[model samples]
Target: MTKFNKIVPDDFNVPMYVNGEFFILRPLSPVYSNLDYDAVIASKEILGDIFSDNWPEGINSREDNLRYILEDYQDFQDRIGFSYIILDDEESICIGCVYIFPSLYEGSDVAIYYWFNVKFAGTYLTVKIENFIRSWVVEFWGIKKPAYPGRDIPWSEWLTRPRKKFTD
Candidate 1:
């Protein structure tokens, strides 16, 4: 089933940035059709491992890709209320990107979806991206919201691990 509603960006206009050494993320919309399509294709090429690595096969051609991006960004926009482009800061190239959307699991905070080009792996970009998203969470949802770290880790582990617990 489709994960999100398909709505235009005019309804929810809040914009935020996720900083990185090579790239920065700014809000995206259909108006930036050419740029957004280029970024999406570049992202698919760079972070294909995580982004399009497992995408259903046989989706060839630009038309197929455009349809996919339309649905993909639309779902993200509907779910997260925003989307952003992955831009290279130095040369101003579009390397790859990430997306934030409503959490699927109950009792969880917002969902943070990150996919960066392989060239960006093992860089300060990861930490900066994490910190940026953390700041966004704090600003939009408040620090009191509980975030599940995922996996089979126990609630005790999460509560006792580093950083303050949501509920004492």
Candidate 2:
């Protein structure tokens, strides 16, 4: 299968950071382990629903969360995927995360997923982030079609859909 990086232009330069009215997006790293871990545990339930999977369940310590962020950093550095930790405007708190990568399901050029802390569960900030991501992927990555698996497609239906394949 063709990889996402293969489709990206050699000169493509993704944004190092993105700023929004309510939040900021920065690449995931171990530096924010304490803040990230606390946020994850605080919003584990909302995250479970957003991802439609059990995760962070096994994350019992800051070390566990650090490992997770390390993987995200590795994937990003390797150009396999991109994961960013969402932080409030002041940049002190970790509110959520966003993942952008090749689509696992058919009919989309890319897949994007995001979630906020439970406190922002139903706030306008959720709408702001969702809108920002939808447009950001298209403009930044030149994605013609972006799939929001959990938000746009029900997880059950999304899981049963055909997996995307790319040929060289």
Candidate 3:
């Protein structure tokens, strides 16, 4: 049996730059309400697909967005999950989000999900950020092999192997 423990930190530092000029990952909070909401609304189509079943209908509204942000903060505080806002360094714009949570997959203990603005899709920085998160999660959280549930390929086939150029 696998032993479960809280792997995420209580107070997360922000503006962690994984790909220097491309983007940075910062902890999400109520202070980011307007920016985050705008990003979500701008990327609604993409996020809808990623969060297919659970996508909120009222995500376009500031009130609903604030509630979601607050809930995310609470979840992070409660050690239930962690969420981060993705910001474009060049423009200082909120572009996307990353979420890590207890796995809902049958055999996995942890799961990771991320999304970026379509404009940033297929960029080298995307691959770098993905690799960085994978390594960071393993090293900082002590998770031997985190899983990307619902992905087209098995985690063992790609995640455990060396990083490669991301293909469509």
Highest TM-score model number? 2
Q: What is the lDDT of residue 43 in candidate 1?
A: 49
TM-score of 1: 0.56
- lDDT digits (tens) for residues 1-168 of candidate 1: 433432224455355555555567765544444554555555454444443235423245556555756765665545433456666675255544455554444554444555554555557876676566667656754534435332233444543544322222
Candidate 3 local lDDT, 65-153, one digit each (tens): 99988988876767767888777785367777788876544445577877776666567877777677777777766766576743544
Candidates' TM-scores? 0.56, 0.89, 0.72
Model 2 per-residue lDDT tens digits across residues 1-168: 455443366577866788887899999888778888988999987677788668768788999999988987887877667888889998898878888877877887777888787877778887888788888888877889888888888899989988766555
Candidate 1 residue spans exceeding 4 A from truth: 1-13, 16-22, 30-53, 56-59, 75-81, 140-168
lDDT of each: 0.50, 0.81, 0.67
Question: For model 1, what is the error of residue 157's alpha carbon versus the real structure, in angstroms, after optimal superposition?
Answer: 15
* Model 3 vs. true fold: TM: 0.72
Ranking by TM-score: 2, 3, 1
TM-score of 2: 0.89
Error of 2 at 11 (Å): 1.3
